[model samples]
Structure formats: C-alpha cells, structure tokens
Target chain A: MQGMIWLLGFLIGASPDSVAQQIMWRVYNRPSFQDMHAQITMTLIDPNGTQRVRKMETWSKKDPKTGETKMLIKFMEPADLRGTAFLIYQHKDREDDMWFYLPALRKTKRLAASGKSGAFMGSDFSNYDIGGGEYEDWNYRLLREEDLDGIPCWVIEALPKSPDVEKKSGYSKEIRWVNKENDLVVRTDHYDRSEMLYKRTVVKDAVQIQGIWFERVIEATDLDSGHRTVMEFTDIRVNQGLPDDLFSIRALGR
Target chain B: MAISWLMVLLAYTHLGGYLRFESFVRVDSGYQIHKLATTLQLRTTLDQPGISGFSALNLIMDRRAPDPVIFRPIELYLTFHRGPVDLTLGKKILTWGAGVFVSPSDFVNPWDFSVLYSDLEEFREGIEVADFAYYRGNAFVELAFLPMFRPNTYPLPSLQIPVPAGPDTFVVFMDGTHPVLPEPTLKKGEGFLRVGGTWGPMDFRLLAFRGFDRDPDLQVRYVWLPGSNPQEHPPDTIHLRPEYRPVWMGAGTLTWIVGPWELHADVAYVRTEDTDGTLPTVKNPYVYGAFGFFRSFWNDQWSLGLDLLVKRIFAFGQTPEDPMGVNALLEEQARMLNFQYEETQPSLAFHLQGSDTRDLWRWSASGIYDLRAREGFLLATLSYAWADGVSLQVGGLFSGRKGRSPFSQMGRHLGQVGFLEARWSF
Candidate 1:
C-alpha cells in the first residue's frame, strides 16, 4: 500500500525530495509478518582476523492494538552472559523503553532509550540499526538510480533533520541502497560526524518465509578499525502468535 | 542440606557457569601474596511439566581462607507459574530496589561486604523465602516471607577508646565478635510486601518490611575492678556483643529515564527500638536515602555515573545531661558501636568507564568519598577480553583517610593491594 502511494506521488510529479521520502516510507513500512522468532549467531572479527562467536534467541511482536513493537532477546552462548535478556518496546511517537536482566544479579535494569547510537552487544551494529530508525528523523534526498550486480536500486542520501538528531545519532549522513523491486534497504554507508565513512552494512542474503521477506545474513564492518561483525539468522519462524506475557519483565528473568 | 539431596535426585537438563583465578599482592609494603584463590561456579536447571527447578553451586579454593576449601549453594529454588500468578520457594537471589551500587531499600538478603568490589556473585547470599506474586500488564504486587534472619558479613576492627576518670586518660580497646542470630520463630521471621509498576518512562516501587536490621547493634559490656580509676587502669576486657534487633521499615524507589540520562532515587525510613536518643548503646532511628544518575557520552564509548547517599539520625545527641549540646560521649559511643561519624552523614560515589571502538579493551574507575568521615576509597581496573569466554583484568584497590573511620581501619589492615585476575566461562 505504501508502494502504491509512492507510485501515485511519483506520477503526480512530486518533488524529488518528497519522492525520495515516499520511497523511504515504503521501505520503512514494508510488508512483514505479525511476529517472528529466530536464532541468531553473531561473529566478531578483529583486524588480525581473530573471531569470537555469540549466540542468542529473539522474539518480536508488533502489537496491533497500540502500534508498538515489542522484542525480547536472550543470550544463549558465551556462558558468562548466558540467561541475560533484554526487553524493548518501541513506541510510535515516543522514545523506546528498554529493560535489561542479568541472571547473576537477578535484577532488571531500565535504561534510557536515547543511547540508540551505542553499539549493540559490542557488535558493529548500533542499537538504532537493530531497532530501525524513525523515518521522520532525517531529510531524504534521491541521490540517483544505480545498478549493483545487475539489480536496480535507488540510492537515498539522508541527513539529520536537526542538530539534536545528528548528535544523538553520532552520524553526519547516511546513504541507503533501497532495492527497487522489494523496497528493502540492502546496504547502508554510515558517515561519522566529520563526514568520514565510518561503517558499512550489507545484506548478504534475503529469504522469504510465509510470503514475507526476511534478511537472513548481514555483515557490518567498521571502515576505520577494520573490525567486522557478521550476523546470521536461523530457525526463523513467523506469525507464531507470540503471547504478550513473553515480553514482560517476568519473562525477562525466565 | 535438603537442597543437596534434591539436586542429586533431579536429572540435570542444563548446566553453565564460570571458573575464575585471582591473585592480589600488597604493594604498599614488601611484596606479599595478599590473596590467592580459585573459584568454580556451576548452575543447573530442571524443567518439568508444572514446575522448574534451578540450583547454583560455588566452590572456592584459597590457601588463606579460614577453611581453605569452601563449598556452598548460592541459589536453589523452584518456581510455579500459571496465568497471572507466580510462586517461588527455596533459596533465591532477589534484588528489590532500583539503586545500582548502594540501595537503601534493598535489604531482601544479607550482603557480604568482604568482596564488595571484587566478586559480583559472592557479594551477597541468596535468602530462603516463600515468594508469591500477582502481575497484570506493567504492574506487580509481591509478598515474601523469610523464615530466618541473616546478618551481613564484614571485617570488624577493634576500636580504641580513651577513658578519663580524673585528669588523665587511659586507652582501652573494644572488640566485636559475631552477631547473635535471631530465634527461628514465626514471630521472629521477616516479611516484605512490594508494589511496583511502570508509567511511561518512569517506574516506582513501594516496599514495607518487618524484619531485623542486617547491621548489628552492639551491647557494650566491660569488666571493671572495684576501687580502680579508669584513667590510670583501664578495663582489661571490653567486650562488644553484637545483636540483631527488630525494626519497622518503609521504603520507596523511583527510576526515570529522561533523554540520555537514567535517574534513580531510593529512600528508606527505619524505626528502631530506641526512638529517643537517651540510650547510648542502642542505635537511634534513621533515614537512609540515595540518588544517582547515569549517562553515556561520545556515542556510548564512555559512560559516567554519580550516586549520593545520605543518612540522618533523629534526636541525634539529645541526652539528660546536655539538652542542646551534642555530647562527646554519645558521639564516641556511636562511633565505637555503629561506625557513624556524625548525626547527618553523606557519601558520594562516582564511576566512569570507557572502551575502545572494538570493545576488546576496557577501563573503569570508581571512587567513594565519605565527606563527614574524611575517608575515601578508589578502585581502578583495566580489562581485556581475549575471547568470547576468556578474559583478564588488572586492578588496584586503595583507601585513604585522615582519622579513625571504617575505611581507615580497612586501609590499615589491607594496605594498598594490586590484583590480577583471569576468568573462563563455559
């Protein structure tokens, strides 16, 4: 439906910037299942090629009643962090709410959601990347049409709408590669506050589960440090009708 | 124990934990092995149809320890959950307050202050409780009953007092022994009720407790010879008997996540037996409060936190002799018995930590300053993670004080020590 609106706007001779935002809106509001459960393996590789592995299980549900997305992630590997869980609630019009639970402490700690620019579990992916950035926080402009590996793509350049947003994001600009066919952002180039290339993320694989597209493999690398993090998703289950109780603090401890 | 028997009978479905080796040397003097220890921790779980059981076992091997080889169970509990109600039984670790380091409302279990800045798990022991909870949406009401009282464990140093009978004063040493445990009766048991919920970016907890103070109250007893001047010939034996007394407490905690900062506050009001400050041996009623905030900077590469704790005693030095004046004898008694330096005591702590972009190498420093006591402690550590399961840390704990305070005594005993630790989790 969002794609149809973008097409209609394009046919009505909308401005290039508005057209770019329309395209981004389609990408942000792409069709997906109601809920999902998956197992993820994250590999961190240093500049010298040394690799460390971590594993986790995640469950995410989009609440239809409130239009909020709730996610729970539990670390399953690297025994020190085993039984550690995080509960996140992403609201539509406000900052997210996060709860972190440690088995050793047997306590749940609530964290401020404004630290979205921080690394996620020491991985190259920031919390903002994991939670998906808000569409209205940036000004989008259509850079140009490009073809990568014989696939048509629209490169959209996004600049923070305000200095506060830029400071919170720790980024000067981000250029995203949106697949023209599926409205999926397959690649992104992140720039530091000085407008230097800081990180690059590319989707290695995308699979369809129950007629819903899912990115199965992603690799994010720090351009400056030569450190890389590769994430692989397995055992993906969609539309499992996950219960609301699974996202509560009680389940976080369990 | 019964839990050991149950552990042997149940089939282990899952197992996890860590092994740690640590060594500390006194750097203030000729190098000496201050502490050398190896610890092994194991946690196992059994998930069945209607109930799930969990147990954690800890084993420590330290040549300097009293027993040398110590083994204990950290947590052994079973849980039953159905719909909105949940029940738990046996020994379990429960954190009831919002404060990170110093929680005025967190008295669910006795703390082991010996490892306050070292081992995270051994800093406190699990309490045996029967817990019941009812939850709906973002709110919960919990009720817990602890059938016995457990006192905090910390190193106790003898205090030297100068007693004056005439124009001269003689020094007398008073030492404290282990605290007397409360009787295991239904009336002597502890109970707690907590109601908490979250609203928007804030959460609050109200707690009511009927229990004994974890910190002991001293009962001073001295043997004095007849016709002996205390100034010239002080008492040969001054025994400090530590006893736990019942107290009524009400506490509340609030946490607000605003912008990039997380703010938390905890306040507790304890009503002791000595409501008035007439008795020098008994501890007077006091209010304990802590406020703190944590914020990250430089895209979360560096984080800083500050916590301030204040304690105020009511009717601090009101005695029959001196109605308005703060009595020196009462102050001395409080210092010797309770380690309280002033009527209104305040301490501030700051923690700062940062890491490299890869997060492979990290450094953190934390310090606490007791303003009234003029005492301070600092701990700084540099750590490296070699692998996902392996890590190494080098740190030092230092204390400084101007006068006779708890930190001063601890500093005198421990000196300045540097430590190296390696850990492997599997």
Candidate 2:
C-alpha cells in the first residue's frame, strides 16, 4: 500500500511543462524509419491567383547512431531548372549542412548555415521548414488543448531558447497544433523577429503507411507578401533500405 | 547534311527525340534581322544487371536572313556505367571549373558565338571525346581524351570591324589561309585530368590539361611596294594567317560558404610554346585567376552574382620588332596584338536576377566591365511566361566605352540591339 501511494504521488507531481515537452518530442520525432522516397510537386500561388508549379524527387535516410538525417532533392520539371539538385545533412544538435548543384554550371556549391531562414527553391516554405525544424533549440509550452478540423490537437507555443537561435531562425516564436492521434504537427503560426505573425503552415492531408504517418499535402502562406506555396507528396515509399553512397557529394552532380 | 546524319542515327534507335522551335526579331540601328531556329534532342537509356547505357543527341537548324539554312549537331554522346566507373564516347560538351562568368579551366569545348545572347551553357559546341569518371565515397576523378580540336566561330566579316587602315595608306587584301590544325591522331589529341572532392564544408578541385588554344593568333605578313610617288602614297600587300599553338594548363579551384553567400575562386597557369615571348605571332604564357561571390535573397526570388578575373602575361614587352616601312596597317595590327599579349587585363562581371513568386515574370540585368580598357557591355531583359513551355522576352544590349577598346569597337559597328524573342518547347 505504501509503494502504490508513492507511485500515485509521483504521477500527480509531474509538471505540465515536462509532460508537454515529452509530448512535443514524440510529436516531432515520429517512428524511426530507415529511408523514404517521394515525388513532390510544389505550386507557388500569388494573391492574384496566378500559380507556377515545379516537380522534384526526394530521398531521405536517417542515421541510427546519431539520429541525423540526410536528404537529396532533384528537380525534374521545368526545362530551365532541370538537373538542379540539393543535398542536406541535418544533425540533431548542430547546424545542418546543405549543398546546391546547378547543372548548367556543373558545380556543387556549399550553402551557409543562415540558409535555414531562406526560402526553399523560391517557394514560400523556408529551408528550415523543409529540412525539418530545429526542435531542440526551442522551448515548448503547452498552451491548451483544442480541436482543429474535427481532430484533437495539442496547441503548443515554442520560443527560441537563445538569441543565436532566434537570429538564425528569423523567427522569435511559433505556435504549433500537433495532432494527438498521430503526433503529427498539423498547423503552425510563425512569428518573425519583430514578434509579428509572418507565416502560417497548414497540413491538409496525412495518411499512415506501414505504421508511419506521412504528411501528404502542406501549404505555407506568407502573411506579409500574401504568397502561398502548396506541396503535395505522391508515390511516397517508407522504410526502404537506401545505400549510403546516394548521399555523397559526388552523386550530386550525377 | 547534319539532318541526314541525324535521320540515319534515329532510324537505328528505338527511342525518339523531342522537337522545339524558336523565333526572334531584332531591330538595331533601323536594321531588322529575323531568326527561326529548331532543335531536336534525342535520348535513350538501357539498364541491366551491373551495367547501364545512355546516349543523347542534339540537332539544330538555324535560319537567318542572308545566311544559308545551317544544320548542325550540337551534342552526340554514348555513355556506359558500371558500378563506380562511368565511360562516355563520341561528341559531348563538358564544363570544367567553377566560375559564373569566367572559367579558365573550361578549355575542352569551344563556345558557339552565334548564340551570344543565350546562356553560356547553350553556347557550348560538342567535340569528340572519350571521357572516363571514377567515383569513390565523396571524391571523384575524371579523365577526358579529346581526339579533335574545334575552334570557336566568330561573326561574319560584315558584322565585324575590319583592321583599320590609315587615310594615307592603300591596302591590298590577300587570300586568308586557315590555321594548321592538329591532326586527329592519338599523338596530337588533347586530354585533361581532374580530381575533386569535398572536405568538411568546402569543395575543391585540381586539374591539368594539355591542349591547343581555342582562339588563334593572327600573323600578319606584309610587303611595302614603291608607289608612283614614294612619299605621297604608301601601298602594301597584306596577308593574314591564323596559327594555333600548344599549351599546358594547370588549374585549381576552391569553393567556400560564408553567411548568406558562396565564395569561389579559380586559378590557372597556362604555359604556351612561346616561352620567351619573342614570337610576334604566338601567344605568351599567362596566369589567369577569377574570384566570384553568389547569393540569393528575398526568399530566393532575387539572385546576385559578381565575378572578377585577372590575366597576367609572364613575359611582357618582348615582341619582335617590326621592320621599317611596314606601313600604318602593320603598325595598327601590331598595336592590337601588343594590347592583347603585353598587358595585364582585369575584368569584372555582375548579374542581378529577380522573379515574382509565381515565376511567371522575371527581370534580369548583367554587365561586364573591362577594367583595363575602361569599356563595358550591359544587357537587361524582362520575360513573361504566357503559357506552359512558351514565353516571351524583350531585352536590350548596350556598350559604354571611350577609346578603341573591344566594346567600343563593337558598339561603333553594332550599336545597341533591341530584340523580342518567343520560344516554344515541346
């Protein structure tokens, strides 16, 4: 009876902040997948309703030891941009490394760490959003529980833990609505350095494939410019064993 | 002739090609020039266990006023891949080194100056070669054997300024002779080796090449003949000869990423046969280097690039003295050659490009400044996409120069050209 009482007391004493952190980590981390491949179509839409579309193929793999992820994206459509590629290596606790290849120049260029705040291929989505957010650099707080589009979600506010991260991110804080069912972030509102709402991201469709939940349709809108980017993933394959050589720099030009 | 050959090749291959057509009209100095061009690109691939095969062919038809219907093959290559080794044969275009406006290591393929307004990559003319590439981990080694030497083409004489002749001199033109090109043989072939890899956040390459210069040096021989009055009239018989000399080039390049920008540099040392620089008709050894910075801003909608290049001749002020009474024509020719070989030249180029979020409209401006000559060329264009695979562009080319610089000379002849081009790709 004494041991049971001790266990109940410990459970009751757990702070809400600690519980939110755990839930946020679980929501961002997801199930461990060896590799994934997908064909993604990005459509940029202006406030006037004009749109431009681009297509690309993406391959990603996770390192089991370091929990680092390597991704390769190669453009397929638009003759002018054909053969353009980007390779990214995301570390768990350090800045990500990225390289861009221009086929016309036949050279691969390393990109700066500050590229995380830049747009991804002229789209509304920031490089950080496409590379996966820097989750560990921010402090999360559980604001409330809410229902978004008939799905239960945990509304969490994330603030940069340090000034360096805040400056590098071009964002001061962000509010995310994470789906409780799959621990997938479904919506986010990003606030810029001036503490003004700058952009909003909404995940429209998500499906479970082989026990892994994947975001299928995502839209990012720039609040200031009224520009929107819609990304749709098709032919997605998860948990496929990929060769390490595919992530090498030599493969970028090829 | 090129179309017939392409037809034969296509008849044998199961895979087909894509066709594209483009048209443009330029109005310069009240002169209207119209152009219609067609291109067909063919590609095929085969994949099997431990082996793969791929080939590409590009055929073009360029038609303009007062010129014949020219048919040419831009690229034709066959590639084989096995494991980490890849081999390619036939006519192919390859680009080496890392520079946006200037690349000292891009010596294999010659540029097609006929398409000067197009992108640099589009100006490449393929040459027959055997290329081999080996990849290991993050590093790569490439070797190319070029069996033939192809020189860059220049505009028609009517479109270019002739060698200036003084008012007091009368010139007699002689038949121009072609350069003695290197024979297409194993011994006379050219080759290059490149080894490149990435280290941490930087990428580097070391390269060496043995080849002939793409541009030829003009050797003008003249004889002065006695006129009816020797003091009043000076008449000369002039002969222009083009010569191509051998060169050995060693180059290195490095690329580093700083905050919000990419920094790259390339240096090449060219050792020519004219070591002592005494040959009035041969090019001297020189060192060329370029530094560039590139960055994209405003959510990648705007891109800005700047490149600076320097070329220094090893032996300056070492040309053979001209004989007395060589006439003013010879003096002018020597002066031009001296300007090219004896001086250290520095040039700067910058490009700015911006596009709308939808990418339907784009504006770009680029300029090249020859600091040594104090001359520059500027180009600006605005393009709008009307539909899929179709676009319209309007652009203007201008030059600013005060002296007898290359840009100044060109501006005197061509002035400024305004062009409207419509393109369709399918």
Candidate 3:
C-alpha cells in the first residue's frame, strides 16, 4: 500500500515543495525590465542599540537580459540634507560609475567600488550591498524547497564571484522564502561577519497588481543587537503618471 | 626664495595690463556678533608690497597667482610622488596638529594648500623649509623643517612710560642676528634645532627652542583687575636670563577606525627649564592635552562631529603679589593690583556644524573657552566654491585672555575680519 501511494504521488506531480520552487522562480525573475520611483526610509541600529533614521527618494530601473541598471537617489530632510544626490549606472561586466553630490561643498565626487563595503546612511548595509532592487547584481539560484508554518516555500542561495562582488553583497549566501501561492518572497535571512545568521527580514501585507505580488510592509531585525526597523509603504501606485523629466537633473534645480 | 619671487614677478610683468580684481564680503548678525569686514586682494607677484592695507584701503596686488590664470605650474613648483611618498615645493607649508583653537605649526609662518583653515599670519616673517613625506597604506611618516624669522619693524606712537627712541624719530626693532636653517635636512643656522619624525599613527616632534634676546622695545603697562584699572610697577630687581636649548617639546597622536566612527586622540607634552624671561614662573613649564572626535552623518547633505579636548599647562609660580616688568597694561576699572602674570590654560571645546565647503552657501559656527585664563573666543565663517575649482572664503577670529601679572592689562575687544580669494586649476 505504501509503495502504491508513493507511485501515485510521483504520478500526480503536485508536491508542495515543487510548487513553491516553481512559484519562486516565476515571481523573482518576473518581467524583463521594470522601473519605479520610491521613497525609502532606512533606520540604522548600532551595536550600542542606538537607532538613527534617514530618508531618501530613489528612482531605480533594471534590465535583466542586458544585466544593466540605473539609480538616482536624492535626500530630503533635516534641511542640510537637501540638494544631495547620487547617480549610479551599473553594468555587470566590471565596475559601476558612482557619483555623489554634496550640496554644501557644491561638488560631485566620483566614488570607486572598492569603497562600497563601508557604511550606507550609517546603516549596516555596505555601499557594495547587492540589493538595490535589482536582479542582475547577484546571481540567484534556487537552492532548496522548505516549508514555513505549513506553507510551502522556495529557498535560493547566491554566491558573489569576486571580492568586489562580495563587498557589494552583504551576504555570501542569502535564503529567500517564497510563497507557493502567489510567487512572492515572504521572508529572508541575512548572515553576519562570522557567517552566522545575524538578521532576518519578513515581508507581509501583500497586494497583487498587474498579475504581480508586492508587499507593503517590510521588517528587518538584527539578531545580535536586539534592534529592528519597520518600513511601511503608502501612495502605493504603480506605473502612474510620472513624467520623464521627473528623473532628470534639470528637475532637481527647479 | 629670491629666485621664486623673481620668477613670479617676471610672469606678472608679461601679463601687461590684464589684471583681475575680486572681493568677498560676509555679514553675520547672529549670536552676538554684528561686525563687518571686506577683503579686496589683487595678484601681480611684483617685488613690492603689491597688496597692502594702508590703514583705510587694502591694496592686494600679488605677483604670483592672480585670478583667471589657466596655466599654474607656479602652484606646482616641485612635485615629488615616488611610490607611496609625495612632496611639494615652491611655497608650501606643513601643519601637524588638528586644533581649531590653536595650531602648533603656526610658528612655522607659511601658507598651506589645506582643504580648510587658510587664514594665516604674515608670510614675510616666514622662512623657506624643506617638506618631506612617506606613506604605505596603514603606515605613514613625515618630516618637515620649520623656519623661524623676524618681521620688518615699524615705528609706533610712544607711550607715557618713556621708551627711548633711536637717532631718528622712529623706534624700529627687527632682529637680524642669526640665519634661519641654512641647509636642508640639517639645522644650518641658529643656536637651536627643531627635528622630528612621525611613524605609523604616532607623531613625535621635538624642538630645541630659544627665547628672548633683549629687544628693549616692549613698553610696560598696568595689569588690570575686573573692577579696577591701575598703573603697573615692576619689581625693583629683575632678570633676563637667556637660556639655549632651555626646553624639549613633543606630542603624540593615535588614530583608528571602526564602523562609521574615527577614534582619534592628540596628546602633547612640553618640558622647559625654569627661565627668568617669561612671566614670574619659578619652575619648569609642562603642558599636555588629549582629544577625540566622532564623525556623524545625518544624511547626504548633513554631517556633524563631536570632540572633547582636555588640556593642562603647569609651571611653578611664586606668591600672587610678586610683580614683573615683562608686559604691563591698563585695567578696565582704573585700579592696579600687583600679582604674578604666570598662568595655565585648560579648557573644553565643542564644535558643531552641518558641512564644510568653499561655497558661501555652506556655514559653520564655533566657540571656545580657556579655563585658567578666564577668557573665551567665538568664530563664524561662510564660504562658496564655484565650479572649476574657484572659491571664496571669509571668516574672523576673536582672541581675548585676561591680564594676570601686575603689569598685564586688557579690556573687551570688538573687531571684524574677512577675506576674498579666487583660484583656477586645470
């Protein structure tokens, strides 16, 4: 009876783990290209348990086939932080051109990738951190199928090939838990300097738009420091009426 | 020195009549400072006082570097970039300390191409010194020669203390006794030597220095107390015991980085022999100070730093009533009190600012207090730097220390300072 039941399961091809893996690949590697303008708030928790918050407006666009992306970030707050900008054009083959504009200094400094491993907005994120809402910066491979809370999910493992790549990637290998139902990443584990699980992020409150699942609430917690940050999204509009000039340097002056 | 000046003059003469003029004026009306100063400077590098502030007018006609010049090899006279070592020649200065209140290298008396703080004293009293450097990632080393010089002496109105005048109506006093450092890497001239080297994160500096050679020009004044101003009367017996190699001075610094914080400290110690030249001190003087600062970036446009500097200067002293003829001044309340002028300055300093730039759009405010001297100073500067490396900066410094010796005296001061400069590079 057990052998017959196993054969029946194999013939059905409806295993929960296989379903999660399929969903994860379909969701993360969705379309060829997508662009969005977002207001990002990053909160940094130091080893001493002190918290600092910073806000920036960013416009990011990525192309997976050509492995290219462009980012424009502008700071808005605390008066002194206004008028500062960062423009990055990324290419997969080698280095990316990074430019930082200092309002007070009235100058733009070109930064190299070797400096990416440093702090970002006083946060733990390295300048070279691989996220940046892109798919090409990291080589993603479906590692395993796992279940969380009786829900099937797919786990992915990524390894950076070069030292520069590693510096930009805060993880040697990050595991993403994608829900089988909607092809959305539900949770992620970020490692630490010792290659131990140091932090985790949980994404919830998902809403499907244009046949895609997007989460509105993202929470990241530091395991060692007992500190965490909660980021919520609003004005959740996708592909609304955003002018081309809105992303141009000319608009910054006006 | 002669060749460099003549080279600058020849270049200016070739320019003919195309001389540019620029001036910057900064006005601040906040935090109890409501003063104004306008700096107008011109460049020709001519062999004369091309730029001068003739009491009322500030004529600046520098012959070396004027505005709007594209070719600036003059600014890059001697360039040395061998391996990890870099050096520069043709009018450049080296500064060792990071103190905003006081810089020990100010005694070197020269201008530096520093990214910050360029308001320097008269360069005419500055001598030529060799600049050196070495660097290999984490380990770095540097050695420099600081030349001491005497400035041109001018005549001033005589006071009621009866200062004897020379054959003419002027009482000029410019010392030309010894030549300053005649050789590179060797203490060529002078009775003392200043040689030091910095290794790794450590800064070790020792200066064999000398003091006071009977100028007979310092006029005496009454030392004033808070409530009264009085006439200064020197003790009947006095001494001007000139001592050679009378002191050995040194300082140390350690800097390390962790996360976003740069932990740094500046520690200095100076031990000098008990001399009769300065004040009423009866024992050797020693001074030491250590400080640290952390850089905090609020956002891309905003960054702030917090620093705490602890300093102490001690010297043996006689009883309070002992008087000195060294320097005397009138008091504010018109009453005199006899006391030893020797003192120690120990204080805490705090500096907060949004950003630092050569553009007038960027601003900064700074304040400091000297504990033992019971005095304080405040400074503010606004600057602007345009595209193409052209910039303008204007700032002022207010220094006030109370009179301690019976012959020492000073009152509150109200003054203004500003500067307007422009530079172009390829």
Using lDDT as the measure, the top candidate is 1
The lDDT values for all models are 0.81, 0.72, 0.43
RMSD, each candidate, Å? 4.0, 5.4, 16.9
Error of 2 at A166 (Å): 3.9
Kindly report the fnat of each predicted structure, to 2 decimals: 0.65, 0.41, 0.00
lDDT of 1 by residue, B75-140 (tens): 899989888888999998877676656688987688875565576557777889999999997799
How far is B303's C-alpha from truth in model 2 (Å)?
2.5
* Candidate 2 residue B262 C-alpha distance from true site, Å: 1.4
Superposed model 2: Cα runs more than 4 Å off: A1-14, A45-51, A92-95, A105-107, A113-115, A221-228, B1-28, B34-63, B156-177, B219-238, B322-342, B400-414
Interface RMSD of 3: 15.7
| Ranking of models by lDDT | 1, 2, 3
- Work out the TM-score per prediction: 0.90, 0.85, 0.42
A245 in model 1: Cα distance from truth in Å?
1.8
Error of 2 at B52 (Å): 6.5
The residue pairs found clashing in candidate 2 are none
- Per-residue CA lDDT of model 3 for A1-254, tens digit only, reads 32243246458975634443344446656653266676766665545655555567777666546757666778753233555788666766645645456643333333333345444543444454434434434556656667877767667654454554554555565677877666667788876545788768777576676666777667667677666665555444455444443333322321
